[model samples]
Target: MNSEEGRSRPAWGYQALVSLPARTSTPTRELGRRALFALGLLVITVGLVYFDRGAYQDNNADHVVSLVDAIYYATVTITTTGYGDITPVATHARIINAILITPMRILFLVLLVGTTLEVLANEGRRVFRDARWRKRMRNHIVVVGYGTKGRAAVKTLEKNNCNPAQVVIIDGRPSAISDANIGGYAAIEGDATRRDILRRAEISKAREVIITLDRDDSAILVTLTVRQLNPSAHVVVAVREQDNATLIRQSGADAVVTSSDAVGRLLGLSAVSPNLGTVIEDLLSSGDGLEVSERQVTADEVGKSPGEVMGERVVAVVRNKTLRRFYDPTVARLETGDQLVVVRRSDQAAAPLPSGGERREFGGRRGR
Candidate 1:
């Protein structure tokens, strides 16, 4: 194929249709035909009324009004609203009446009824569909924002079988709403930082909420709103600045995603272990394969060791300011409130680390 043909090949499906060239006949002829047809219909109705007026004789005149009055009556009656103020005195006048008026009246009523019923039927179907969708959704991840980071988070949720239907996105931008399929997914248009919008998306009912907006302030606001609306909900807020991660966590986010920290680690890994970096990227960015998970060691997991509970291996641990590696069974003992980051395949199921152990002040650890 030539270069032009090769360039055109990529355009197909809905995208191709939208990119196709517009034809002059498409809009021009359609509008012209409609305008002409409406004018013709109006002229015919007026002519028929004039013909009917001439037929009314002196016998009709005794109780009759003017021709204008008869035309007004015809207009009102055709609208399916007979005021009953004027009556046709003669049998011939009512019998051999305007050819268009009766059928036009019937058509008008039919159109009115049809439009009304269609709207009601459509609204009913929407309600039923939304109810079904909401029912099938449980513990589904809800993501706020659809920027670069937010889109990445969505892919992660889907890769982990989070259920596409259960995923609800709350973003203020209309363009973001239009980008994805959005057919089965529920997306609300509003500022995620606003409490009303969060409530509208049923944040309290959401299993998890991830805020990945570009602005740190926006993310912080969203984290605060979600915490107040849903204290139990697992909230993950993204922070571009490394220093802001702790602030985000303090603002009620269960966890903070630091892009700087992540990219820095990734670059370091790529230098020492290129193959490992590739594997990690594929797992995080793709829809299948391995996934990253982080869970805080609660008071419940204090006494248990990592090997005893976590099926996956710990990648790293953040204890105080030091980075520690998972050594063996002895080091596996997790204190209460230690953050553990682990990597596991998507299909593999895992139980939470053991619960109910002695609390300690080893700071915290970030496990891979």
Candidate 2:
């Protein structure tokens, strides 16, 4: 989207969108491959002329075609720079030149010109692709920031069967945007605090927004803007200070993760009790060891106490959008409609998405 259309753009900033699962090749690598092909053609031409040296004439180095002369002749011929010093005198040699050398020359020139055209064509394709992607973007996730926390959030999403194509990134740093593109996610290059930038990402239509900006103030501003644009979108923000989490949540963030405090707590646990810390870390990390999952309660488990449930350890139960610890008296019995957050071995089969369950999403009713 144009800045003028957004009415909230900075004078110096512009939007650059990159969509996911992009099949891209570096310009240098493409060019190098083409160059090798061109070189191979030259080599073939040189070999043909050298083998039939008796049918050629080199005015500069006697009537005989030396290896050097054949190389020079091939180079000039393929480049269409016929210096007239080397001439194919025999009828067979002339025929060979017409049939083989001429086509190779044309192909070589086309290769050179095609490279330039490819670069321009790629730009037009990129613009067209971006337009299509923007039009189709709806109910997608927008990740504002590409730092460590943001990266981890995306990784977790992917681990849980989330398509990387369903995520968009918004970052002020060009390098971060580039990384997002490389990682197969559409990205907008600009400050997340800017409404125009968010609009470029189609934040109004996004299903969720994750803000992991460098500062708490920026996170709050972004949360407010996103909530203003999309009131129903579940907004999650990460802050360095625990004290700012409440303010961020008040600013419309559905959930706030204090990055610094969480890490510090982990460090403290690791220092005091290594095994407990390691187990906690394992639960938090995906893809190995034990994993925490949310699944719908089976019909057989209805009215059963949390302790009676088998196959996995039930830690919490969710019913009617309320979270209840498994040990809580209110959630002592598992209801058929309730969802359970359980800890299971990574090798175990994962629970399917429940008809009414929120995974990695904040689900408590908060005062607005």
Candidate 3:
């Protein structure tokens, strides 16, 4: 597509939609709240006019006032639609009109103007927030697809101490973007597979890109696009089929998670041995149960056997970006600058690594 494709894609305004859930309310909810308040004012005005029917004079009817005429009077009065058909002739009614009703009318008018006022305020905030984001967008993670897998990935990142501000979500579905926003994240709505959409996310400056699309083909396309944009970034892809995993990895994903195969394996294991599956699921799950974390070798742990390490169980070792099984003789003893992949309890905080430790994807097969 041409560079102007972003401009002509649709009427959806990306800048207008950027928001932090913690700071501001969505336009829809704000408008609804104001509308409800305005309605309440109308109800109170109607009650006041109807309850004191004798205080008002109606030109259209006789000296008596009906509920319908009271409602009509309140409606026209609050809206400043002076039909001249209704008048409050009593001294008390006129005094109430001067003191109370006038203020309520001013409030209703303020509420009406509030819609425009809030828009202007939010617009200015959006512009400032967008500028700040673009300025500080370097080396942040870009996650495409806010579906089940995408949500889980982001949660895992956050649980590992990753900042919510450091992660950006890209999804083609408006509903998914809304969900992400409600979760207190900035989300861009558009097809992530498109180069222009990826560019809008500042793909080139991103430190990592995660692709968890439902369709394997789409996952591959996004992986390719991300790799093309940011070659040095660590790209991860979660695909449904194992066959597509290889293709995605070849497309430049650092690691590939075969979702369907992993789930199937867990199902089979559960059928054969229930406890084994439960333990694995616990490791896969976040929080106090069990977690598999990759962290740097502490000074005391260095020059020691993996089996001698206290508490967490060392499952594997990552040396120079290569994964080595714990049983492998070379990694039997940890060395300085070595990274260990260990299964530890979530209640205890894992030691921070110099390179920013990451959580490994569970239930995935890889070459040692």
Candidate 4:
């Protein structure tokens, strides 16, 4: 199993045991073998301990073997740290001693060595695979900044079940250390604005370039460079001020998120009409929030008025730099340079009509 799969599985205590019985018989039998091996070593060690007693009692020809001394000598012998405090005097006992424990000692060493080597081999293979992954990747998403919004975006992408191997991030400031959690996702340390740093991040091949830098100017520059390198890439730039949104969008960004405008409107609406705000919040959030969507009227809706396109309310229609209130969708005209803000009904796809208002691309296309 791969490391990720192994980690995802239940702990060893709960998982079904495998290959154990075939190699070593039942658990009882395995325990018995281990016990025998241990007992054999104990016997050889006890012989060594009694050897000391034999030395003092050689003239008497009788030496009592104490259990405590046997245990001490057993530990010393198994560890191969015999202190010379014990010696065997009887020739037959010494010869029998070597016969009993030497084979068991060799078997223990072999098992320990094999297990250690196997562990080392598995670890080495994992390191090699990680290195290979780092060297071979391109056209992936590279998050260039780290903050609450950046973290939320990364998490949302991950939650969508996107492959980790396809995402990369670049952030140089020490404050962006939290981004390290995405280690398996490609990462590099350097200034994102520097063309060389962007090149190292493989910006040319990236599918999406997100500029959520803490500073607006940095985001603007990053947006410009990314558009110049990969004009087709969908770039999402975050602007702290609402006015900067147009600037970022004009710099070749597909979309721009205004933090202040969103936050301020949310707070203001919540204060006057909390219930309405809650409903809107749900739509904006992952939950069942009201989804405010926009679609440019295509050829189908060319003759039809705004009411047919927006079944409910036509909040506002934009023509050039002018913004006009259009409460009545029936009277609103679908003309060039006109954008209709409509509330979605049931997550259904809205049909497009012939363009009459401003030529505006809502979801997919960006106005150049």
Which regions of candidate 3 are displaced past 4 Å? 1-124, 350-368
Estimate TM-scores for all models: 0.60, 0.64, 0.64, 0.45
Ranking by lDDT: 2, 3, 1, 4
Better of 2 and 4 by TM-score: 2
Better model by lDDT, 1 or 4?
A: 1
Superposition error at 184 for model 1 (Å) = 3.0
Deviation (Å) of 31 in candidate 2 = 22
lDDT of 3 at 340: 84
Cα lDDT tens digits, model 3, 51-103, are 88898988877758878988898889898887989889899988988887788
Candidate 3 global lDDT: 0.83
Cα lDDT, all candidates: 0.66, 0.84, 0.83, 0.64
Candidates in descending TM-score order: 3, 2, 1, 4
- lDDT per residue (tens digit) for residues 1-368 in model 4: 89999899889787776634224254445445666666665676566555544432223224464566566655665656767554455776567557855655565555444544555576679779766755676667878886777766676566445577787777886446444553456666788888888877778888987777888889999989888887778898889998888888888888889988988998899899987677656555542323444445455555556667645445566556455666555436667445666555433333333443332212211111
* Separate clash counts for every candidate: 12, 0, 0, 20
Query: Least lDDT summed over 10 consecutive residues: which range in candidate 4?
Result: 359-368
